[model samples]
Target chain A: MPLLKTENVTHFFGGLKAVSDFNLRIEPGELVGLIGPNGAGKTTVFNLVTGAYRATEGRIIFDDQDIVGLPPHQINKMGISRTFQTIRLWNEMTVLDNIKVAQHGHIQYDLKDIFLQLPRYRNQEQAIEAQAMKMLKLFNLADHAQQPARNLPYGQQRRVEIVRALAANPKLLLLDEPAAGMNPQEIEELMVFIQRIRSELGVTIWLIEHQMRLVMNICERITVLDFGETIAEGGPDDIQRNTKVIEAYLGVEDEEIS
Target chain B: MAGRSGNLFSSIFRPVGRIVSPVWTALRRQLAQTPVLAFQLGVLVAVLLEQWQGEAFADLLGFRRIPRFFGIVDIFEPFSDLDFSGILAPFFPSPNNISASPLQDSVQALGELATTFVKAFFYQGPRAPGFFDVTFRVLIYDIVVFVVPILIIAFLLRPLVSELLRRFPKWSLILVHLIILAAIVLLWGDDGGTRELVLIFMGINIILTVSLNLVNGYMGEFSVGHAAFMAVGAYVSSVMTMWAFVDDRVFGAPALDPSWGLPVGFAIALFAGGIAAAIAALLVAFPSFRTRGDYLAIVTLAVNFIVQSAINNMEGIGGARGLNGVPLWSDLSWVLLTTILSVFIIHSLVNSTFGKGIIAIREDEIASELMGVNTKRIKLVTFLVSSFFAGVAGGLFAHVLAYINPGNFGILKSTEVLVMVYLGGMGSISGSIIAAIIFTLLLEALRPLAILKWVVIPLILIVLMLFRPQGLFGFREIELNWGWQKAKEKPEVSGATAED
Candidate 1:
C-alpha cells in the first residue's frame, strides 16, 4: 500500500479554484518533485496534504488512516511535516530550540514530569537534544546551534528550517521551494542533502520548487501543474519532452504542429 | 488468582522502585551541589517536628514564646511616657492660665502645632543607651521569628514539595495552599495593624503581576484592561457577599447570616467573581486575538472603559456612588492562599507543553501554528486563566477594603499592574513576585509624600527603563535547580559562514 494517497482533492479560496481534481499516490521513500508556475497551486497541494487547509472535496489517506479535516499539528504528528516556501523559523529561539520545538509531537512525558523535571523529562529531553544535534550536524549547521535563528545567514536559516522539519520524525517530508533563494553552489548542496535524507533516513520526499533545473536533475519522478490542474506526470526526461509541460512553462503556440 | 495477584504486586512495586531510586539519586546530587539547602531543610523539618510534638523543643530550650522584634509600640513607648507639656511650657506663653491677649494665645497654639509636627515626623522620642541594647536584641529576635523560618521554608519545602509533585502533583498544590493558609493565620493573628495590611496588599499585587504576566509577557499579547477583569470580580463578589451577609442597612435582606455562613458565602462569591471575569475574558479574547499587538491593546483598553462605565451606571450596586458594606471576609490568610495558588498554577502551566505553545505564540504565532501548536486554543485558555486570577485578586481587594467602586478598577490600576510586570521582567515568575513586593512596599513607603509620590515613582520607572529596558530579570527565569532538573545547556554553534 502507498504511504500516502490523495484522491480527487479540490480546493477553492472563495470563488477562485486554487486546486482542482488533484490526485497523488506516493510509495514509501519515493522522491517526487512538484513543479509549477507562480499560481499553479503547488504549495496549496502541500498545504492540503498537511492539513493546513481542508480541501473542498477529497480524501487524504496517510499510513492507512483518513487524515482529512485533521488540524495541521495533528497531521504533522501523524508523520507528515512540511517546510514553508518562505523561511518560518522561530526567529527569536536558539537554533537548537527551533529543532527541539518541532519534536514536541513525539515528546511523551506528562506535565507533572516536565514541571517537576522528573527523570522521564530529563531522559526525553536528552534524547530529543541528541537527535536534534545529530540532524544539525548532518546539515552542517551544528556550529550555529546556540545562535538565535534570526542571527543566521539566509542559506543556513533555510538549512535550519529543513532540520527543524526533520526533527518531527515525519514519514513524509515536504519541501516548498527549498532552493528558492540559494546560490547555485548552495542549490547543488541542497540536492545532495535532499537525496541523503531520502536514502539515509528512509523518508519519502515531496518537494515543490520553481527551479526547473534542480527539479529535473534530482527528482526521480515529476508532476507538472498549471492553471490549478496537473498537466503532466512522468519521469524527468518524459516531463521535459512533453509538449503540454513545455507549453505550461513557456507559452502555447497559436497553431500546434501535429 | 495467584498469578494475577503477583502481577498486581509487581506493577505497584515496579513504579515505586523506579520512583525511589531516581528520587534518591536526585536527592544525593542535590545535597552534593547545595549542602546549605539540605541544612535548611533539616532545620525546617525539626521545626515542624517540634510543633507536632507540642513545643517540647522550645520548652526544653526555655523559650516561652517565639521571639519578636521591637515594633512601633516599643519605639513610641518612651515618647508617650515623656512629659512634653513641661518641655514646651518655656517655649510658649501661657494662654489660658495667664489670660493673655488673642495674639499671644494664637502664637502659643502655633508653637504647640510646630512641636507636634516636629515630634511626629522627625523624632520618635529621646532614647537612653539601654534602647540601643533593646534594638540589638530585637534584631536578633527578628532573625529567629521572621528571617529563619522564611529561609528554611523556602529552601527546604520547595524541594520536598517538588519531589512530592513528581508523584502526586495536584495534592502537592494543596500542601502549598495549606502552608500559605497557615502562614496567613499566623500573621493575621498578630496585632501589627498597618504592617499586616501592607502584607495583604502585597499578596494582591503579586496576584495581579503574575496573572498579567501570563497574557502580556508569556503569551506576548498586550492587555491593558486587566483592571477591568479585577473590577468585574470585585463588583460580582462584593455584591454576592453584601447580598448574602450584610443587614438591611446596606442593600437587600440577608440571605445568609454573617456569623455562620460568611466564610462559605465569601468563598462562593470569590469563585463566582472569577468565573464571571473569565466569561468576560472569553468575549473579549475571541475577537481581540484576531488583531495583533497595539490593536489588541486598544481593544483591551476599550473593554476596560466599557467595564468601568458599566459599573458606573449600575444604580443597584451604587453606580457612581460605589458599593459599600462588603463583609471583611478576606484576611491576610485568604490573600496569601490565593497568591500561592495563582503562582503555583501559572508556574506549572508555564512549565508544561501548553505553556510552551503559549510562549511559541508570543514568539511567532504563524510559525507556532505551522509547527502544530494549536495557537488559538492556547491563546484562549491563557487569557481565561490570567483573567480568572485577576478576578480573584479583585475579590480579595473588595473584601480587604470592605468596599467596591468603579474608580478602584480604572486605567491607572491596570497601569500599576503593568508597571509591576515590566519592573519584574516579563516571562519570569519569581521576578514578577519580587517586583510585586517591591512595588507594594515602595508605594506604601511613599505614602507620606502624598502627590509627590506619583512624581517620584515615575522618575524611578524612567530610570529603570533607561538602564534595563527588558526589566530586572529580562527573559531569564529563576528555576530552582534541584540537581535533577538540568539547566538548559546551549551548544556553542561554530561561528562559520554558511559558504564554508
Candidate 2:
C-alpha cells in the first residue's frame, strides 16, 4: 500500500481555486517531485496535504486515516512533516533547540511534569536532545549545534530546516522549493542531501522545485502542476520531453496584451 | 582618613580572604544547590553557638543584633556594654611594642589581625535594612510564606532552568527576595506610610509588566490593551468582595461574615477575577487566529473598551460612579505574595518546553505549526495565562485603592502597562522588574507633572524606540551575583545514537 494517497483533493482561497482536484500517491521510501511555475499551486498542494490549509473537498488518507480536515499539527503528528518554501527557522533559538522543538508531538510529559521536572520529563528531554544531536552529527552540523539558526549561512539554514523536519520522525517528508534561491553548488549538495535522507532514514520524499536541473537529476517520478491543475505526471525523462510541461514553464504565446 | 582606611582594609583582607576562600566557595555552592538544607544547618549552627557562647558572642557575629526588624533588642544586642577595644588590644599593632625582627613582627601582626577579623563577621550597630536582617523571625515568616516555597519550587525546576541566565543567581536570589520581603515587612510595620504605598505599587506594577511581557515580550505579540484584563480582575474581585463579603452600599449587606472575608474572600475573589479576565481574554484570543500586529492590537484595544463599557453598564456594581467599599484588603504582603507568584509562574512557564512553544509561535507561527506545535491551542493558552495574571494585578489594585471605575481600566491604564513592558525591555523577567520599579518611581516623581507625565513618558518611549527598541532588558536577563557563580556548567554530551 502507498504510504500517502490523496484522492481528488481540492482547495480554494475565496474565489481563487488554489489546488483543483489534486491527486497523488507515494510509495514507502520513494522519491517524488512536484514542479510548477510561480502561480502553479505547488505550495498549496503541500499545504493541503500537511493540513496547513484543509482541502475543501476530497480525502487525504495517510497511514489509512482520512486527514483532510485535521489541523496542521495533528497531521504533522500523524507522520507528515514539511519544510516551508522560505527557510523559517526560529532565528533566536539555538540550532539544537530548533531541532528539539520539532519533536513537540513526540514529547510525552505533561505541563505538570515539566513544571516539577519529574523523572519522566527528564528522561524524555534527554532523549529528544540526544536525537537532535544525533541528527546534527549525521548532517555534520554538530559543530554549530549551539549557534542560533539565523547565524548560519542560507544554504545551511535550508539544511537545518530539513534536519528540523526530520527530527519529528515523519513517515513522509514534504519539501517546498528547498532549492529556492540556492546557488548551483548548493543545489547540487541539496540533491545529494535529499537522496541521502531518503536512502538512510527510509522516509518517502515529495518536493516542489523551480530548479529543473536538480529535479530532472534526482526525482524518480515527477508531477507537474500549472494554474491549480496537474498538467503532467510521469518519469523525469518523460516530463523533460513533455511539450505541455515545457509550455507551462515558459508560459503560452499571448495574441495581445491583456 | 577614607583613603587610609580603604588601603588598610585591602591590605588586611588580602591574605585573610585567601585563607577562607575555599570554605566560602564550598558554603556558597551548598547555598546554591540546597538552600533549604543550608537554612536548616544554619539554624542548627546558630542554636549551637548560642549554647556554646553567650548572647554577646552571637551579637558580634551579627545575627542577634544589627538591623533588627521586630524592634526587640536581643540579649546579644551589639550596642550593649560590650567593650570591643578590650577584646581587640592584642590585635592592635602598638607602635611602642615594635620588637624583634620585622618579618616576625609582620607575621604576628597578620595573625592577630586575622583573629580580630574572624571576631567580627558583620558590622555591629543599629542601621537600615541590610545584611543580618535575614536572621529575624519576620524573615522566617517571609521565607516560610514566600521565599522558601519559591526556593523549593526553584529547586524542583533547577534542571530545566539550570540553563541560561537563570542558573547564575541560584543562591543569591533567595537573599534578594528575602531582602525585598523583609524590607516590605519592615516598611509596612513602620508608621512611615508613603514608602509603604510605593512598595505596594511597585509590587503591583511588577505583576503588570511581567504578566503582559508574556504576550508582548516572549510571544512577540502586540497586546495594546492589557489593562482591560486587569480591570476584569479588579471588578470581579471587587464585586466578589463587595457583594458577598463586605457590607457595601451597592450590595447592601455582607452575605458572608466580614471577619473571615478579609482572609478567605480576597484569595477566592482574586482567583475568580483572574478567571473572568482569562475568559474575557478569549475575546481577543479568537481574533488572534486571523489578526496580528496592528490588527490584532486593535482587537486587544477593542476588548479593553468593551470590558470598561461592560463594567460601566452594570448598574448594581456602581455603574459610572465606580466600585466602592472593596474592603481594602490588598496590603503589602498580598501584593508581594501575588507578585512573586506571578513572577514564579511566568518564569516556570517560559522556562519549560511548553513555554518554548510559545516562543516558537512568536518566532514563526506557521513554521511552529508545521513542526507539530499546536498553534491554535498554544495561542489560546497563552492568551488565557497572560490575561489571568493581568486580572490578578487588577484585583490587587482594586483592593489597595478600595475603589475602581471603568475609567480606571481604560486605554490610559493599558498605556501605563505597555510603557513598563517596553521600558523594562521585552522578554526579560529581571528587566520587567527593574522597569516596573523605575517606572513606578518616575510616575510618583512626575505626579506633580500631572498630564505632562504622559508627554514625558512618550518622550522616553521615543528615545527608547530610536535607540533600544528592545527595552532596557530586552531578550536578556540580569544575573544576580554573577561574579559569585563564575563556574561554567558542562553541557551533557550524549553519544550519537545508531539510526533505526
Candidate 3:
C-alpha cells in the first residue's frame, strides 16, 4: 500500500473551488514535485494532506489512517510535517528553539516530569536538542543556533524552516515554495540540500515550487496543476513535453487562461 | 406553572424590551467600536446622572449608598496605638542623654528617619503578635501549621498526583485541587486577622498577575480587562457562598450552615467563580477570534465595563452599594495553596508541548495553524485558563475582604494587573510572581504617603517603563534545573563544513 494517498479531495471557498477532485498516491520514500502557476492550488493540496484544511469531499489516508477532519497538530503527530510557502520561522525564538518546538509532538515527558525536571524530561530535551543541532549542522546553521531566527539572512531562514520540518522526524515531508526568494546559487544549493535530506534521512519528499529549474533537475515524478485541477502526472520529462501542461502554463493559441 | 410564570415575565417586559433593544444594540455597537471612549462616556454619564438626579436616581436603581473608599488612616489603624518610639529609642541615642552638639543631633535625627523608614517598609501593623512576643510553643505551632502541610503535599501527595496525571490526566487536576483544599482547611482552622488578610490578598494578586501574563505576555495578546473576569468570579462565588452559608439572604434561607459546611461551601464557590469567569471569557473569546492587539484590548476593556455595570445594576446582590456578609473563608493557608497551585499549573502548561503550541500562535497564528498547531483552539484554551485563574483570584479576594463592590474591579484594577504582568516581563512566570510581590509591597509601603502615594507609584512605574520596557525578565525563561547540570553537557560535533 502507498504510504500516503488522497482520493477525490475537493475544497471550495465560497463560490471559488480552491482544489477539485485532487487525487494523489505516493509510495514510501518517493521524491515528487507539484508544479503549477500561481493560484493553481499547489499549496492547497499540501494543506489538505497535512490537515491544515479539511477536505470538503475526500479521503486523506496516511499510514492506513483516514486523516479527514483531524486537527493539523494531530496530523503532524501522525508523521506528516510541512514547511510554509513563506518562511514561518518563530522570529523571536532562537534557531534551536524553533526546531525544538517542531519536535513538540514527539516529546515524551508529562507536565509533572517537566515541572520536576525529571530524568525523562531532561533526557528527551537533551536528545531533541542534540537532534536539532545535528540538523542545524547539516544546514550549516549550528553556529547560528543561539541567535533569533529573524537575525538570519533570507536564504538561511529558508534552510532553517526545512531543518525545523525535518526535526519532527516526519515520514513524509512537504515543502511549499522552498525556493521562493532564493538567488540562483541558493536555489542550486537547495536542490542538493533537498536531495541530501531525502537520501540521508530516508524520508519521502513532496515539494511545491515555481522554480522550474529546481523541479526539473531534482523531482523524479512531477504533477502539473492548473485552475484547481491536475492537468498532467508523469515523470519530469513526460510532464515537460505534455501538451496539456504546456497549454496550462503558456496558454493555448491567443486564448488567455485567466 | 414555570411556563406560565415565564410567559407572564415576557409579557410584562416585552414592550419595555422592544423600546430598549434598539438603543441598547446601538450603544453596544458604539461600545464595541471604541470601548475606551464608551467607558469614559459611561463614567461621564454616570457622574452627570448622579449630580442631576442625586439620591432619587440611586434610590430608583436600589442603590442604597456609595460605600466610602478605605482611607490610608483606616489601613494604618492597627499601628496607630502602638508606641514605636520605644522600639526605636535604642537605635537612635537620645541627644539629651548624649549631650550632643547641633550637628550630632541633626545626624541622629537622620539616623532615626532611616530607621523609621525601614520599620515602615517591614511593618505588618501592631495588631498581629510580634515575632519576639510569640512563645516557643506558639512558634512550633506556627511551624507545624505551615511546614507540615507543605511537606505532606510536596513529598507524599505530589508524587501520587504526578503519577495520576501521567495515567489518568484529567483526574489529576481534581486530585490536586482537593489536596490543596483539604490542606487549606486543615492548616488554617479559624485564623483571621490583618496579617492573614494581607497575605491572602498578596496570593490572590500573584494569581491574577501570573494568569493575566498568560494571555497578555505569552500569547502576545493585549488584554487589559482581566479584572472583569475577577469580578465575575467574585460575584458568582460570593453569591454562592452567601446562599450556601449566610442566613436571611436575598435567595431566602441558608442552604448550608457556616459551621461544618463552610469549607465545602467555599470550595464550591471558588469552583463556581472559576467556571463563571471561563464562561464570561467565552463571550469575549468568540469576538477575539476576529480581533487582536489594540482591537482585542478595546473588546476586553468593554467587557470589564459591561461586567462592572451588570454587577452595579444587580440589586439582589446589593447593586452599586456593594455585597456584604460574604463569609471570611480565605486565610493565608488557602491563599498560599491556591497561589502555589496557580503557579504550578501555569508553569507546567507553558513548558509543555501544548505551551509550545501557544507560543507558536503568539509568534505567527497563520503559520502555526499551517504547521499543525491548531491555533484557534490553543488561543481559546489559553484565554479560558487565564480567565479561570483570574476568577479564582477574585473568589479569594471576595472571601478575604468579606465584601465586594463592582467599583472594586474597575479599569484601574485591570491596569494594576497589567502593570504587574508587564513589570515582570510577559511570558515569565517567576517574573510575574516577583513583580506581584514587589508591586504589592510597594503599594503597602507607600501607605504612609497618603494621596501622594499614587503619584510616587506612577512616577516609579514611568521610570521603570522608560528604562526597561521589556520588563524585569524580558523574554528570558528561568528553566528549572539542578543548577549547572545543563551547562556541563557539551554538544558533540563531527568535522564537516557546509560544503562537505
Best by DockQ: 2
DockQ for each model: 0.25, 0.30, 0.24
Report fnat, model 3. 0.37
Residue runs of model 1 more than 4 Å from their true location after superposition: A1-28, A37-41, A48-79, A94-160, A166-171, A180-193, A199-202, A210-214, A226-231, A241-258, B1-191, B245-248, B251-254, B257-265, B479-500
Q: List the candidate 3 regions with Cα displacement exceeding 4 Å.
A: A3-24, A37-41, A51-71, A104-147, A183-185, A226-231, A240-258, B1-200, B240-272, B290-299, B313-316, B452-467, B478-500
**Global fold similarity of model 1 (TM-score):** 0.68
Would you give the TM-score of chain B in model 2? 0.63
Candidate 1 per-residue C-alpha lDDT over A50-162 given as tens digits, one digit per residue, 9 for 90 to 100: 88888899898999999989888888888998899999887777788888878877777765675466888778878888888888877778888888899998988988888
The sequence of per-residue lDDT tens digits that candidate 3 reaches over residues B359-400 is 777898766765656577778988999999999999999988
* Residue A105 Cα positional deviation in candidate 1, in Å, after optimal superposition: 6.1
Going through the candidates in order, what is the number of backbone clashes in each? 4, 1, 0
Each prediction's fraction of true contacts recovered: 0.37, 0.56, 0.37
Candidate 2, CAPRI quality class derived from DockQ: acceptable
- C-alpha lDDT values of all predictions: 0.78, 0.77, 0.76
Ranking by TM-score: 2, 1, 3
Model 2, B1-500: lDDT tens digits are: 12345778867887787878888888567456643323432333333333344245335544443222222223123223223333334445478964446556556666755554433334533542222443353354434434554445545544443443355555565565456455535434433365568778899999999989998888888989999999989998988888887766888898888787867778999999999999988877885657556777878888888888988899988998998788878887788778887888888778666678888998998889889998878778877888999999999999989978899989998998998998998888999999999888776654534455567668977998898888888888885433234332223345544221
Docking class of 3: acceptable
Model 1, total clashes: 4
Model 3 steric clash pairs: none
